[model samples]
Target: MRLVKTEKTGRSVHWPTIAALAFLVPVLLTALGDAKGAEPEHRPLMSFEYDPSSEVDVELVLAVDISQSMDTDEQEVQRAGYIAALTSEEFLNAVQYGPTGRIAVIYMEWGGVDEHFLVADWTVIKDAATARIFAGQIAEAPLRQVQRTSITSALTKSVSLVNENAYQGLRRVIDISGDGPNNQGGSVTKVRDHLVSAGITINGLPLMMKTSTNTWQAMLNLDHYYEDCVIGGPGSFAIPVKSKDGFADAIRMKLVMEIAGLTFDRPSFHPVADRRPVRCDLFD
Candidate 1:
């Protein structure tokens, strides 16, 4: 071993010092990697964490229902619809229509009193690649279910989740989809009203499945119930699904509508025939 001298200062670099740096280079890299939350490799000898901030036209929360009222087959159809919509070329095109060309999305599957499960955490979908990756993740997630329908719980959870997130947006929305009424939680109207008044929109995807059921879980005029109670905000509306086969198309239309921020004039999603108004206070 020999020293590499510093000619300008006439100082000799010792072999021991050179050996010490050689030994610590990898260790230092690993320390930097640990500073980040996680990485591909647990102990990365070298890595970089890129944290870039972005703006978007909206922050949308896809709050879906997994209550038993939706049978396993209907659940499957609903899940499939979202996967198709999220990955569709239309969805990708909708993203580009935004002012910033990106949006933050959160996906939740809920049922029961306090039942809220995150199928996908906060993710920025800016391009086809990112959209596909998100769609694949949701496509692969295990289908889950619980008892009861708590629209109130879903609303509360969504508000908390959005408030705790890191992204800032010009608009914030909770796209709540459910097949039944509020049969299991706190006051849905109160929570819905609070969120709407705070400038956070609540959109609805009122699914009309199990329409003929004679059980306590059955909800007739769910679409009207949603309009009277659940959805509210600027440009907010409910696009009801009338059957299993129409689920995907409904999902796609709604996604494109929300992402593009299109009004009733958008060809993809036309309004359903208006039903007579229901009691917004029916659930209390």
Candidate 2:
């Protein structure tokens, strides 16, 4: 039996009501490498100029959902997909294809308005080894779940992560993955507009998995909700995952596009860009 859960141990902290919230790639090496979990694989390290101040092609914050609505199986799938995407040869190639041949990235999982956890700290990915390390770091960490969905908190935390990052970037992106509408946080649209206006692009990976949750509470046409409400700014886009089988591929595709910065005329391997401008009042 599925028991309902809440993120707060005491009371939930709603950011939107307070009015002052904070904020915050790619390439393709086409290697279809094996995926690993959140554990570090013992491997030889490659030495390079380890400069803290460096320019990256993109600075990305991966903000994912870990609400109670996302069950253990779903969470495992989500986690594995990210691990696969980051470790893939295609993702590494995209990283090298960048003008700087490197990018700074962070991973975060969010649920309730007060529940945002940092899984991976800011790390630079320029080559295969570093990328492997990044993936390993996430693989080794324990999976966490919170109750409720606060996309606003996800966005707000993403902005802060990117802004405080150690490296500068030619572009900034917040790649959000979620399975439901905002039910426990401040206005999703309101915060999205605020972030987009600040010159940060937001992309989305909307999970359209069928669930037996109450229809009145479960979102209808969640892809549309994400397109119209959750993502925005220049070169922003979203890709919806319709099935468990497609989750990993969707993540890989989204990561490749974001890393490539494919505004238009994308290659056959990449998905087409969406020209729709996001609006703040979409869910209302």
Candidate 3:
């Protein structure tokens, strides 16, 4: 059964969905069909065989949200944001000044539970040319929207992607952007802590341009939710996009910070074992 967070007290209450049998039958069938051999049973966090030649300054995973809540227009803007960020001068400069003068990146979009689409595979960006090629790949892919918000599943997939990629880096980061809270999967904080323990940093781009109408679409204090629940590890922080016009700029600044290892002045949201302000498992 799924647990939902009451808006007022932040207390979790469980509910059975058996009353919606007619509506859920097809969804369950579809989910089962989609899950067939989609992912491996076990994936190591890192490969034991490390190649000295494959080292880079950072391994960055861009986990974008493409849930139904993000309209097509917003999706276009989001896509444009990343494209611009990747090719921006600031981002290029950050890479150039890095210890290895290069970083490995992968772009992936997430929506429902276990649903993730890797738009761009791991590519080393040491200069503008390679950055443009990576951006072009993102620009070329057709935009898609899936149901639900599963940041938990997305982060899990990211770990697998990092493990499978043939690169070693001084830092590993998963930059996840979303407009809503986790409402369709396992506990997000559990996975966040796992990643942090494995020496991975997570940053957030919490899009707060629209108010939440339903549990699936958005939430109040999304920035706080991101801070208290989503992001973790050293130097991890969340940037809230309160307006559409700021997407490109926010994305560019975030990219530069992650690549350059620049620390934000804001407070770090690393999870404390006994004290959590936001219930990461508070789902819809």
Task: Give me the candidate number with maximum lDDT.
Answer: 3
The sequence of per-residue lDDT tens digits that candidate 2 reaches over residues 46-78 is 977876457899999999899887888988898
Worst ten in a row by lDDT for model 3? 267-276
Give the CA lDDT, 0 to 100, for residue 283 in model 2: 44
Q: Which stretches of candidate 3 lie over 4 Å from their true place?
A: 1-52, 212-219, 268-276
Candidate 1 collision pairs: none
TM-score of each: 0.76, 0.74, 0.77
Give lDDT: candidate 1, residue 162.
Answer: 89
> Model 3: per-residue lDDT, tens digit, 1-284?
78888899998865665457767999999999889857857966865765666989999999999999899999999999999999989999999999889999999999998899989999999999999999999999999999899999999999899988999899999999999899877789899999999999999999987854445335456877888788999998888897889999999999999999998675543444544476666773
Index of the highest-TM-score prediction: 3
Consecutive 10-residue window with the lowest summed lDDT within model 2: 23-32
Q: Report how far off residue 206 is in candidate 3 (Å).
A: 0.5
Q: How close is candidate 1 to the true structure, as a TM-score?
A: 0.76
